[model samples]
Each structure stands twice: as C-alpha cells, then as structure tokens.
Target: MREANHFNERRTAQAAAFLLHRSGGQLPLIKLMKLLYLAERKSLELYGVPITGDKLVSMPNGPVLSKTYDHMNGAAMSEPGGWDSWISDRAEHMVALLDPSMIRTPEQDLLQLSDSDLEMLQSVWIDFGHWDRWQLVKYTHDKLPEWEDPQGSSQAITYEKLFQVFGFGKEQTDALIERISAQAYLAKV
Candidate 1:
C-alpha cells in the first residue's frame, strides 16, 4: 500500500470520529492516536492501502498520525477537512466527538471511507481499543517492530521499514511504494 504522501483531513477526522464514537465519545489523546496508527498500519499490511493518508511518526509515546496529532493539539481547526467540526478540542488530555449523537448510521457517516475502510476501523477497536493509553504506548514501543525510540524527540517512520517488518523484500517494497506513490501523485492532478 502507499501512503497518501500527505494528510487527508476529511478522512482523518472521519476515522477519528468513528473511533471516538466507538470508545464512548471520548478518548485520552494518546490512546486515540495509538488506535489510529495501528489502524493505518493494519490497512496497509492487509490491503496495501491506508485508512488515512496521514504521515506516520515515532514519538516518545508511540507512533502517531502526524497531522492528526496536530489537529488534536488544536491546530488547523479552520482548515477544510480538519477535525474542528467533528471533534472537540483537547481538554485535560482528552478529546471527544463534537456531536457523537450525529453519527446516526454507518451509511450516513460515509464522509470519505468505504465499507472496507469502516471495517478496518472496527477491527482496530476490537483489537486494541480496550487498552488504556499507557498500555497502548507500551505495546507500540515494545511490540511493534517498526517504532524506534525517538528519545526526547520525534522521528519519521517510513513505509520502507514497515514493509520490511511485514516481510517484503527490498525490491518488492520499492515497487509497491513506487506504485502507491504514483497513485498518490495522480490523485493530486
């Protein structure tokens, strides 16, 4: 799968909302971020596509959706496709869906994801949503082979390293990354 090579605000918000709604309309910021990262990584591993086209990074806590992290910290609220409308700003290190009740049905929430996309989010919730934020942080940093300790700083986690961990050899990984990148480029045109 290819990275969107950029953040997709609408899809990111929708995914976050879906997760937050499933988690009872609120989640600790770190927990929410870990869930999204796991979901994105799972999507790429399973279908060669990501749920959100956001950059991934290894922070001191764990891996996260880079731009989505920014939004959680109250960035880009006024920008198109941002989470401002769907999610409440972080308060006491937690965030909630702005109108969790508004997500009436699975069909109506289709802001940008397909059935497969929705399914992936649910799967992530089932697998890791129950973990407390600290549990998630430990799992990501200790269990996930892709994340490196960034110490007191952050570092980019590339698809290349993840693919390797997923058992893709160099050539195969390069080709897959190239194809995904071309798709991302064409989508921009």
Candidate 2:
C-alpha cells in the first residue's frame, strides 16, 4: 500500500471550521468526524484529492480523519494554529463553534476548495448529513474498503491501498499521487 502525504493541520482546521459553520455552529463529535471522513472520501473519488489532507486511519468504528479527530477531541499536543480562534468547546461528545463571526463566510474557511470541491462536499452532506452517528458508522463500514476491524488498534489506510480499492486506473492514481506530492512539498516550502 502506498502512503499518502503527511497530515496538513491548517487544512484540517479549515475543514473543521467549515463543517461547524455548515451544521450551524454545533455538531455531535462523532457525527462531525464521520462527516469529515465522508466528505474527504468523496473529494478523493471525484477529484483525486482529499479536502483536508489529513491522515486517514482505519478504526473499529470506521475510517477516520486522524489528525482532525484528535483536534476535535482535544487530543493533539498543541492545537493547530487558528483552531482555538474559532472552534471553542469539545464537550459531551460534541464540538461547538466558538465564534460564528470568526468566519465571514464558509468560503473564507474553505479557501482551498475549488468549485468541484464545494460540489462534492455538498453532495456528501446531502447524502450523509442527516444520518446520526451510528448510521454513518454503518454506512462507512459497509461501503469503505479501507475499514477493517482494527482489533482495538488504529490502522493506517494508505492512499496506495485505497487506489486499489477504488479501482482507479494506474495513470489516474499516478496523477493524483503526483499532485498530492507536489502540494505537500509546496506546503513545506
């Protein structure tokens, strides 16, 4: 299985904020994580890119956006920059938007998203947003090939493995990988 690029915290934070805004400033933590995963997965399928660039991990529950999950649960050692400026409380298995004013519009938080990205996110929301946490979990476990019984251990889901599951042509996978690699490189420079 081919590894994907490293997690991008800034992008993850942006995605979190966008979801919070979309949900009207509050979402159950598990539901938020599931939505993020579904949106990223959809983005990958449609555009060969994930919305947040976060690492994807396979857990017993399903596939999760690892770094973003950590942020949502306050597990990260240091919160991603700008995270505290907007997302305020993570309590009772829920994450709440601290400041609605922090973002003038969802577009502001979603600067990285292209028109296609927005469309995919919308599609994901339309399809999955109403499902409660458990329903989302069932859908993911049933649908995503990346999911495996981690047996209580988190397993990394590499893009290389995912490409095989998605049945994408080699050339398409190569182009996606190349673009992702370039973006990762550029983020560091």
Candidate 3:
C-alpha cells in the first residue's frame, strides 16, 4: 500500500478558484463541493493522482473533499490560507472569488496540475456545472460506485476503493499510487 499523503492546500485553492472562475466568480457551497469532487474524480481516472491530496469521504450529501469542505465552511478556524486568500464565503454560504489575481499567487506553481488536469476541470464544469446542488448529489450517488450512503455518518473513501471501481488490479493500482506519490514529491522539490 502507498503511504497516505498530506492535503495540498495550494492545489485545493486552485481548484476552488477554477470553479469560481467558471461560475462567474461565485458559487453555492454545495455546488462548489460537487465540482471539486468531479474534478478530483476525473484526475484520479486519467492521471492516477488527485488534484488535491485531501481526504475523500462520503457525507450525507455525496463525496466531499473533507478538508476543503472544512476550509469553505469556516469549520477549520483558519484564516488567509491559500483558499482564503482567493475565495470568500458569504453569509449565505456562497463562496466568491475575492481577488481574481490571487490565482496567480506564488502558490500557483505549487498546484502542480498539468494541462490535462485543467481539461478535466473545464470539461467537468461544462458538462455538470448547470446542475443544482441536490441534482449533482443525486448524480454522484448514482454514478460513483465508491460512494456509499453515509446515512448521517461520514466514511473515508480511499484510493484503493476508487481504483477497484476503475477495474485496476492490485499490482497496477499499487504502481500507479507509487508513481503519483513520487511525482508529488518531485513537484514539491
């Protein structure tokens, strides 16, 4: 098994900025979460690495990037991290882009996303961006087999489980994880 990786807050902010940019600089919290999850799912399917190395979990709604959700809802007691610098959550629970140029911040390069990753974000937005939060939740629950109904409890959904759904054998999955882990380290270096 591959060692667990820490969450990359920079990448998480980039993903949020991407969604906000596509949604005219503002999005409801639930919709933002859906878009982030979709992009992460696509990244794993295509590149065998997540855009953000955050924990993925099943919530009552759907699959959530656990830490990113916390960051958005202000449940983490954080301030001016990568995400906070670029995004702001209003009283209505909607997140908006505070500074469009924040996407060009120093953390930009640390996001470590390739052109293909950008493609996934744009394509996912194009295809599913119109859906409301509940619709998106229903869609994810129906389409993503790894999503179990948490039924008010949260459940961690590991990469191994995702790889299984993608029909990857143990050896192939392990190798992919190793490669992704190495690439992530190299990017940080």
Candidate 4:
C-alpha cells in the first residue's frame, strides 16, 4: 500500500455510500466524484488527513480520487468490500446505492466510516452540495490551489503539495507524509 498508494476499499466504499445516501441514493458520476474530492480536500484542510486516504490526482475535469475513479468506472478491485458492494454500476453516468435498504435509517452505520469522516462529508455537503456538477468542477479548478491543469493528462496531487497550500512547512509536510506511509505499511502488515 505504501509503494502503490492503494487505498482501503472498504472505507472508501463506505464514504461513497455515505455521500450517495445523502444524495437520495444517487448522483451523477462526475458529481459524486467532485463531492468526494471536495470532502477529501476539506478533511485534509481541517483534520490534517484525508477521509478515504486515497491517492489524489488532478485530472482534466478536476481533482479526483484516482482508485475510486477506477472503481466508479467498473474496474476490478483487488480487495473485497469495494465500490461495487455498496453502489450500483454506472447507469447513464449516474450511480445509486445497491442497498438503499441499508441507508433507510439515518442512524444506521455506514460501514468503515468514522464519526470524523461523517462530519467532513456533512461539511462538504453543507458547503457545496446544492451546486450543480459543473459548478463544483469550476470551484475545484478555480478555487483549490492544489489542483494543476493536467493539460490532457493527469498528475499526482501530493499530500506534500496540499499541505503546503494548507500552510504547512516543508519539514512538517515531509514528516506527516512519512508518518502516513508508515501507517499505511503497518495496516498492510
């Protein structure tokens, strides 16, 4: 995971499920991606860590959760409890929860999500959920300092770069990234 920067599919699934649940169990693919990217950005800003811990990348549309994007596009996941378990296949560029039944109760646990993760999801929703998909894209392109125009290709958006934008110095950013890598390694073990 440290070398590949692979994410916890189960946690990411729950995060996606939580967002889809908030959007009445469905959202356009780009819209859902934008919402998840924004939530991850906000979490990194406020909590000093990303909610899904997925690798971030700047794409043509905007910033994206790379592996999550692959999963959204029906790529085979290497792990169980992946996006397919919680969300439906892309239908007309829209995604819905596979089990709206599980999302019926507001009190029910969204598997692998933490309280802080939920807080960030709600914060992102309150701040930008009502905006249309294009609006969210525009905001990410224009407002977020971490995103670089990939110019027809994608570029990794490092936690170091994001930390710099968040007012962290080089030493601190390097230390934090190293810590995160160590943690990722330990989790894999």
lDDT of 3 by residue, 40-153 (tens): 888888878888878889998999999898888887654445777677765586889877655554335425455776778888999999989889999889999989999898
Q: Estimate each model's TM-score.
A: 0.92, 0.89, 0.87, 0.92
Cα lDDT tens digits for candidate 2, 1-189: 567656766666667777777788888988888888888888887678877787889988898988777777777754446456567769888888778777787666567556776776677777877788899889888988878879998988888778768899888888888898888788779
Q: What digit string (tens of lDDT, one per residue) describes model 1 on residues 1-189? A: 444355677888889889988988999999999999999998888877777778888888889888888889976554564588789878999999998777886558756877888899999999998889999999998999888889989888888878888998889888777776776667668
RMSD of each: 2.2, 1.9, 3.0, 2.2
Query: lDDT for model 2, on a 0 to 1 scale?
Result: 0.78
Candidate 3 displacement at residue 139 in angstroms? 0.6
For candidate 1, the TM-score is: 0.92
Q: How many clashing pairs per prediction, in order?
A: 1, 0, 0, 0
Q: Which ranges of candidate 4 are over 4 A from the true structure?
A: 1-6, 104-107
RMSD of 3: 3.0
TM-score of model number 4: 0.92
Predicted structure 2, TM vs. truth: 0.89
Whole-model Cα lDDT per candidate? 0.83, 0.78, 0.80, 0.82
User: What lDDT tens digits, residue by residue, belong to model 4 across residues 28-74?
Assistant: 99999999988888877776766777889999999999999998998
| lDDT for predicted candidate 3 compared with the true structure | 0.80
